[model samples]
Target: MKLPPLKTLPVFEAVARTLSFSAAAEELHVTQSAVSHRIRQLEDDLGESLFDRHGRRVALTEEGERYLEAIAPALAQIERASQQLRGQSDTRLRLAVPSSLAVRWLIPRLPHLQRRHPDLDLTLEMLADMPVMSERLADAFITIRYRQRGYVSTPLYVERLFAVCSRQYWMQMRESLEDAGLREKGSGRSIRPEWLSRFTLLSAASVFEKPGEDWRRWFQAAETEMPPTARVQQFSHMLLAQEAARHHQGIALSNDYMLDTASDPELVRLRTHEFRTGDEFHFACKQSRAKEPGILHLSRWLERQAEASGWR
Candidate 1:
């Protein structure tokens, strides 16, 4: 019965997952000092440093990773068991999604899902890259092309990227281009594919895809030369690039999955050109759990949502 404060284990996992004390604090709804103190206590009880502190950056030590592998599943099981004991009928599923996709796509529709199925509880794990398949990390995943083999995956949508910018920026650019006689009259659009040279390009990378590849392909598909990146902005996720665009930073390339016309009315999309990459997002889960009623329900819901979104 020699156990450390059981409550502190989650604090450790949060810090390891976020890799920042401040981030972990925000996620746990506690102060940084409180998080640090809890970690100190846990390390003292374990007689080993679980995290390597390097100023603002933090990483899990070797022992920390092993400990997480051991205790995380146990914690999840305890939570599920407690729910059952309370006579709850909810079937909770942990779903791992790319960070940008969660923020731009899944989060907004969460309310609809809850209203539709109250018994299906979901915990979303935002990831910067494709996650390795593990029930401990997530019960299911939304990833690019199966990320790993052996899982049953279904196509969500083919990636279709187009140019997007703040409505105000586009208006200003339109007037300037018109005055300079650079804009074509009767074209019925404020922009042309070749006009991209006038704007900075914002690129994003995720799921092992190249950040700048879409932009280049978009230009090529339009028979326009690729614009120079004299003033380029690169982001680790599409959500950041789109946020930067919303602030009038630059024109960003984004797909339909990451956009909602009603979400950001101030953002204008140039319908002049688009690049349809054959790549698609897929809904997946472990083969062993594929037959579970909860997994089956979630998978069908996701497919229907994708279909309703006009993914062709």
Candidate 2:
């Protein structure tokens, strides 16, 4: 028996996979007529109808489906082998992290990685719009959430939230005002014993639904009620909200990891009361890739880094 042309196989496979001549044509950068011609040639050679046309749609025949199951993996392996032979490991490391963590933690440390591994290609994408990680696109991901039961996750750090204010604002309150006056200006027009209501509360937009709770939890832990007239300014990204807080625009409740004392001297911790959100920073990868060399190296390095940073 003679074998079909190698080129025709790809065309048939594309049409079979997509179930649309136009779709396959678009993917292959060819005309629909060309795709149809290729499939016709392949079917003539094999003496079998591969698809059942239903008006505008198409479905694979049983033989076509079985052929695809056998061919797709072989084709993929061929592509991978070709890439490997070309000395293209395709070692693209894509990391999806929260904007705050990207800004405060990862970006700062990336310089060290760059210096150490100049050949390594890394793509850092901010995960502000997409909250769910460990999806199809990413190689590794970082998230702050409650421990998931089934997935293998490594705890990078625990969240410790406290109130932060601008140093200049604190000084202004100290100089012109007594404790009572300071309390009045900080919390709200009317000062209560807790004094949290005096200042505006800066928050991340998604803080309400995030696994670790928000400012409300912190206030509760402090045994203080939220102020009635408290102003809340929401930022799309937590990093932006934190920057706003540092500039004394408002008081923000955030974790220590997100604060960079070197960059923003105006930012000062307003409260000594540390509250736990029961949520923690985590590094997660697919269970299949857990034992992969690159993944293992990254996991161990992250664990060591977290330990050195005193993340509990």
Residue-by-residue lDDT tens digits, candidate 2, 1-312: 678877889998788868899999999999999998898898888889888888879999998987776687567547656876897754456777877778777787777666655655778778765454533336677876424443467889887777777887656544444555554444434323256556677777555664224666766887876665767777755666778876768777777678756666778776457788776778887665566555566677778768867784
User: Model 2 reaches what TM-score against the true structure?
Assistant: 0.65
Q: Tens-digit lDDT track for model 1 on 1-312?
A: 889899799998888878889998999899999999999999999999999988897988999989987887677667656876897644788999988778777888889888877888889988766757766678899987476765788788788888888998777767777777987644575467777767787877642278676677778888876766435677877778888998988888878977776767988887677877777789888675676667888888888888888883
Give me the runs in candidate 2 sitting further than 4 Å from their true place.
1-90, 129-135, 145-151, 176-193, 209-213, 231-237
Candidate 1 residue pairs in backbone clash: none
Question: What TM-scores do the predictions have?
Answer: 0.68, 0.65
Per-model CA lDDT versus the true structure: 0.80, 0.70
For candidate 2, the lDDT comes to 0.70
> Tell me, what's the RMSD of every candidate?
7.4, 7.3
Candidate achieving the largest TM-score = 1
